[model samples]
Target chain A: MLTKRIIPCLDVKEGRTVKGVNFENIRDAGDPVELGSFYAQQGADELVFLDITATNEKRKTLRELVSRVARHINIPFTVGGGISSVEDVVALLQNGADKISVNTSAFKSPQLINELAKEFGSQCVVLAIDTRQEADGNWYVYLNGGRVKTEADCFRWAKEGVDRGAGEILLTSMNHDGTKKGFAVDITLQLASLSVPVIASGGGGTMEHFTDVFRQGKADAALAASIFHYKEIGIPALKQYLQQQGIVVRWESNENFIC
Target chain B: MNIVIIKYNAGNVQSVLYALERMGIAATVTDDHEKIRSADKVIFPGVGEASTAMQYLRERKLDQVLKDLHRPVLGICLGMQLMCAYSEENNTACIGIFEEKVRHFSAAHADVGQPAGEEPLKVPQIGWNNIFHLKTPLFRGVHENSYIYLVHSYYAALGEHTIATAHYGLDFSAALHKENFYGVQFHPEKSAAAGAQVIRNFIELVPAI
Candidate 1:
């Protein structure tokens, strides 16, 4: 059976982890490689490193960080933030990134999705959609780190992205972000109706939120940042809890054997 | 052992190289016939569309080169799919090393009914899942129901050559072995500890030839 994925997201800036991680015994919390390997050791199904750096050397820094992370961590990881061209994706993949996420560039020129899907298979292309529900009770797509809003409907744009050859959708609800209340079940459920797998992001406060997203929202995966970074919820315990709830997750007992 | 990873137009092979390096083994990535034929072990790693990859191999004559090699050759993901006789993806003919046909998961799921209220199986399964019924030296130390990562929309049908199986909507070949050739549908390179063990087992296998 294909199990629901639990992912730990890291925000990287200038080749270092941006958010303060609370993992004990970690020599350098700023080191993405060490932190990524630590998360893999904790049985994180996958990792997503979002490069939040805005500089001329951002690409070089990310490439170095990606290769360093790949050399240490064995599980698959995705790299995102400011990835617009095929060359950028090529550099990252060549350095060992399993997948790449695109947002603003993809929205500005939707053809970029087709080009990436053509060059590399669709499986490696992840469409990251940032959206927010407005006064009209409709979700609108937002871009540039949720600062700019577009007239495009979230559901329609998601469907269009899928049709254009995005294999997965990372839907982050701006409304629910940092609220720690719960996932945006309504919009997530709608996006999950599409043929592609939907990764529900933002508003994950507790393990029950994960259960609700998987059971009710029908999300194929759930991604959270602070909850994991601050050690508020350990992945092993969360997996056990979800397992007890009858949700199938990839839980292995051989923690000591992880290489 | 001199290991060579057969490189083509397929997706990145750097992860595979990095995985082997973790095992303290350095491998060369090349397409030269002599290098692949002369190596003690050869790994064919791929991550791309079937027909296009097969076309590249055919054009480069790597298909024939691969078939003629007697050394232990292991294929991963699309590399495994291309070892089959035919693929439903883009209606392409494969290398015919394995008699089974590569099939799209959706077409295979049609006969199997989904449990009530369950979400339809997503295409291109993109996460960790367990592999069971291990029967090959490739999985010698790996336990039954060991989880491995996978990402694909198509799968190779279970057949006589199947050494292991996994279930998505139905049971399909997780690993296949025949004589000197071996193939696995999952990306062992990206599958963490258990995956590293599988790669180690393959490296330690005694070539039947």
Candidate 2:
């Protein structure tokens, strides 16, 4: 059986990953290569590098950064940010990224998912959703890094993404992000109806938070940024905790730990 | 010595690379014929849809190179599927090393009410399945019915190359071995200790040049 994965996401800007509160007022974490290598060593199943900057001219920089990270990290890496066309996805894949995430572009043209999946297999395409809970309890999916709201319903878009050929769905809860309260279990469970694997992002404060998403949210993977970046919950310890909970994680002997 | 991982737009190469790193063996991923042909060992790991994967291999003329490899070659998941004669996945023709056709597990077995003769199993057979009935050095010290991680909907029925077997909707080929070529449906990289031991065994089996 495929065990649920634990992934750590890094927000990259101008070649460096930025981690901050509420996706604003960011602080430099470290070099992307170093952080990626650290997470790979710590037992992260996969790493996602989201280029936070919204621009058209920075694709080359993102590509260079991806190549650098690929040189050092051995695990699967997904790159997103400012991806508009199939060319963007190809460029990222050519540079060493295992998958490309499309958010705003997919919303602009839902057919993009189908097209990309047809051209480069569904497993290579990941649909990233930035969702916020409306006051009325309806979750509205946003784009452009949660800056703009789309009329497309969150659940509808998720199913559409899978229908269009997204191998995985990365749903980020804007409401619980950086708050440490917990993941949006209801939303996660709602999205779980689709066959594609779901990766829950945002709102992770502790190791218990991860366990909660796996147990309660029913997510295939739980991704947290600051917690892993700040050395708060190293991946090995987290795996131990999950294993104790009967999650059945693949444990590796940490021979590199020179202690 | 570097292990050459064929990069024909297949998924799970990263997983194989990480698995090798876990065993402290460094490898280089490449699609170039010269690089792959000269390497100590060649790994063709795959995931995702098969038709397009075969298309990519054909486009790069890698199918011929893969068939001609004299050194040890290891294929995992979709990689194993591609090594077969043909796949029902999009009805794609493959490298044809193994004379077997890949078929989707039908729900007929799962819907049945009989205790032994049950209904058809579900599609996209996901999660941890067990692999048993091993042959040769691949299973080396691996225990029978050892639980391994799997995430595929289609499976290769028993054929001339089947090295091991597993049951989901029914008994299916779990691993394949043919001379210098080998294939395992489970993701060795993600299979924990059993998976790592398999990888280590593959590394150890690479014939010295």
Candidate 3:
């Protein structure tokens, strides 16, 4: 069963929607193609934009705001800050973007994650780690966005970005980024114990912190940004409070509710 | 209903051409062989790497025009593992139009969510699971287990053109018909609203074929 995903990460700056508390103080959270088609009509199984103004004229308006949020959203979205090669992931997957997260040229050239998983393959490559924990618990690895710091070992560069192919692993936690006081559940269970698919990202505010980052950070996905950009929380009441706390999310329609 | 999304080199055909422009249906990604042989409906979406996507679908022969398309060809997710017939990932050879094979959910013996030392069930079986055994009409109104949106690492196992099924650590083949050729190891354009009612029941089966 693959349910536990409820992502919301929008970040984009200069074009719109922005949130940053521990990452700074930037605010304004709106209009990323209407808060990403209002979190894909509020079910939000996926969506992560983050192009914090990688300027070349705000990178052509974040590829026209990811082609108008992939033409007013259907679902599966992802696009990260200044992607850095494979023609910026084929211009944001030809202006639509399904997935393509790469943190700072993948830790400054880990062969740009095998040249974007050898040109868009490793399930459309995403290796967005941004750790930072130390004080003896050690986690280190942050780049351009988290503003540099790299001894590398954030579970050995996420097992060498999942051994150079990187199917997925968004993992944020710059000491619980934006500090809402929740996720980073022990390094998102140490990058979900490194098997692969682990999208935990920062301190999500509540909804029992996305059911403790998916039942104690076993996180197969649980990203957030200011608890869904200032609405504080409301991805259909946090997937109806993580489906009344069972946590198998992706719930919009009590029966076909798409819009 | 001209649709047409088979453009080879994988990677989610721009989210299945924005899930057919969010059902307003303005598709056409194209690999060209006569615009996908006079398309009436032909998705074959993907997310890549099956021996360089069958060497870019045999360098554009689009694998014999998607094995002589007579129309109605769904195929999402590595375009339903490159329309089966062989793919141990790089072991290649596909487009047999569903005789099945595509293994590697750790050899498909699958105990469903493997235990005895976790962390093994992650060979790309990516997001939203649960497709249950739903037999054809491309899952019309799709229910049984309903949760779609998959992202592979090679599957397809349960053959005889598996109508639909999904178990992650193993049950396999979540949707793969034969006749008018359809296939969906999930991602009915990122599964939401029961994957947009299986893309409006595959665009109302392109006006009932």
Best by lDDT: 1
In terms of docking quality, model 3 is acceptable
Q: Model 1 over residues B18-136: C-alpha lDDT tens digits?
A: 99998999999999999999999999999999899999999999999999989999999999999999999999999999999999999888878887876688898888899999997
lDDT of 3 by residue, A1-259 (tens): 7788888888888788888877888888778888888887777878988887672233533787788888787778888887778887888888888788887677778888987887777778889888888897798888877777888788888889889998888988878788889888887887787767888888888788788878877888888887777887888888887888887775645464332
| Alpha carbon deviation, residue A133, candidate 2 (Å) | 0.6
Candidate 2 chain A vs. true chain A: TM-score?
0.94
Q: What would the per-residue lDDT of candidate 1 be over residues A1-259, giving only the tens digit for each residue?
A: 7899999888777666654312111222367887788898888999998875532233433688788888888888888888888998999998889999988889999999999999998999999998999999999998876767899999999999999999899999988876789999999999999999899998889999999999999999999877887788999999999999999998875644434
Q: Per-residue alpha-carbon lDDT of model 2 for B98-161, expressed as tens digits? A: 8877887654344434366422333455445668788878777787766676767778888878
Report chain A TM-scores, every model.
Answer: 0.91, 0.94, 0.33
Measured against the true structure, the TM-scores of the candidates, in listed sequence, are 0.95, 0.81, 0.34
**Top DockQ: which candidate number?**
1
Q: Residue-wise lDDT of candidate 3 within B60-113, one digit each (tens)? A: 788889888887888877788888888987798887888888887766646354
Model 3 stretches with alpha carbons more than 4 Å out: A1-109, A128-130, A133-139, A142-169, A177-180, A183-202, A208-221, A224-236, A239-254, A257-259, B1-43, B48-55, B58-60, B63-68, B75-186, B207-209
Model 2 achieves a DockQ score of 0.24
Model 2 stretches astray by more than 4 angstroms: A55-61, A252-259, B1-41, B45-49, B52-70, B105-152, B158-174, B186-204
Clashing pairs in 1: none
Model 1 misplaced stretches (Cα beyond 4 Å): A19-29, A54-61, A254-259, B206-208
User: Comparing candidate 1 with candidate 2, which one achieves the higher DockQ?
Assistant: 1
Complex DockQ per candidate: 0.76, 0.24, 0.27
